[model samples]
Target: MAFSAFSMTGYASHTFELPCREGLVSATIHVKVLNGRFFEPTFRLPHALAHLEPALVKMLREALVRGTVYCTIHIGTLFALTSRPMVSSVAIAGYIEALNEIKKHLPDSPGDLISAANLVGLPHVVEFVEDPVGHEINERILADFSTVVEMLQAERVREGAVLADDIGTRLDRLETAVEQIAERSREVFAAKRQRILENLQQLVAQAGCTEDANEVQLQHAFAQIEKLDVHEELVRLRTHIASARSILGLDSIEKGKRLDFTTQEMFRETNTIGAKCGDAELGGLVISAKVELEKIREQVQNLV
Candidate 1:
């Protein structure tokens, strides 16, 4: 399998059987990984092997970077008793008394209703303490476990490859959009300056100010012009696009979180550009860039 960044979602199953002194102990492990804000693991295991869950979870956590993992382990034994079931005497007595009282109301109830069969039927009345796996058997199972994990990681890598391609294509489009918006740079500055000059002229005209103060009004307008300029915003937008591409090109496993933060910065810059937009074409380009960034964000959810 190609090793690179991968999605946090995948599935894999493996069955292993070993001949032990007592019997043949077989285990079928099914692992399912789903996207989550953080890493968490839940395991469903047969009681005979439940005590080994902590070790199993630790192995998976070390192998996987992030995900909400659900792992199921079903162990079967042939020709030997792996565990001895125990009956809860207190629970059985309570269940029998409860059942007897209920039977009194139902005259048609059978005489065998409160027998041992009925007592065992009640939940938690019978229990078996999961036995710890033997060291040799545990080692064998864990060794095979690495193989299954490799299968899971392979699937994640394949998924990441596809997602990276899609995200990279969108980044290219964003770069082109940024260039076009920069090319239309003069229109935006001109519009902002015109608005500032008109506002100053209106203020002077309304107050019936003398012509000598018109120079002060012009200076004020220039200051506002400098403040509203979008060169910085455009430059940052382009830089964010470049950064995003650099991250995508890397084969590192940490791409997901980095890309997530970079896209947020890109979105911030796009919003600022949109606010300063005076031309319909620039506004449309900004909207398009947002759409592409949105798609990129969705794809990023799967990356590792």
Candidate 2:
């Protein structure tokens, strides 16, 4: 059978590498899904890269329909660390040229030495730009982000399949419970009719001077017994069961809301059946059926 249901919970993780500067940086993305009515995405990225949240959220909103998604991206250098700082050739050349022109007018000093180490502490001369091409790196990683989304969707589909199977089984059990209630309702109806007639006859014998039972008294008694008629309720209950089964076997992604609504209707019918039942055993069966419906509802809540 096709599984139309989908779960609100899922998990997936992926790691990717993108080139930055003269080396490569490794990054990992983790995705998690939780219950929600809409596509709510929240991300935890590096402070410098937090601006990418809007773009990532937009992509997720387009990919997912319903769920609170938590995606975290962690990036770090793949190579070993070094104490030496990288120097900017452009900045160093400008600083040396400007300093040499001023040195010609200065007093002749033997200690006017400008070493390479001195340039390391100068402004804009030394730099350690880990990811020089930030925009390009971001674009590349975001392109691979589709893989993470696919993994998360696959997990949700697996969960949805399991949920559909469980709900289907519960629906079957509910159908059986309703069937038992229908049978008991019939038995209860016959017993109620016989007992009410017997009581009416007894009343007629006690109050009337005539030997024949009072016709007006029998009519009143029959009117009271009519309240015990639960045929319509039983028929409606079976119809609701069939509808629930059909919804479960569907292949639609929007089936969650519809399935939930159908179960609520079934619950209402079960309550009506209980109220109309005068027999303790029949009332108990109706309650059992209600319990089964409740079980189905709980499982359906997780569906998409």
The Cα local distance difference test for each model comes to 0.81, 0.78
Relative to the true structure, candidate 1 reaches a TM of: 0.75
lDDT of 2 by residue, 1-304 (tens): 4556667789989998776545666789999988887778888877656677888888777766778889998877533211235778899889888878877777585555588788678899876544333577668777878789888888888998898888888878888887888888889889989999998877777887353447667668878888888888778878877887787777666567788888888888788878889788997888888888888888888887
Model 2: how far is 216 from its true place, Å? Answer: 6.9
Name the lDDT of candidate 1. Answer: 0.81
Specify the highest-TM-score model's number.
Answer: 2
lDDT of 1 by residue, 1-304 (tens): 1225688899999998865656677778899999987779998876656667888878888778789999987767632435557788888878878878998999897887666676677798998754455777667767877777888999888888888888888888888888887877667778768878889988998988777788877787888787667799988988888888888778677688999999999999999888877678888988988999999999888887
User: Residue 74 in model 1: shift from native, Å?
Assistant: 1.1
Q: After superposition, how far is residue 273 of candidate 1 from its true place, in Å?
A: 0.4
Deviation (Å) of 58 in candidate 1: 2.2
How far out, in Å, is residue 125 in model 2?
7.2
Q: On a 0 to 1 TM-score scale, where does candidate 2 land against the true structure? A: 0.77
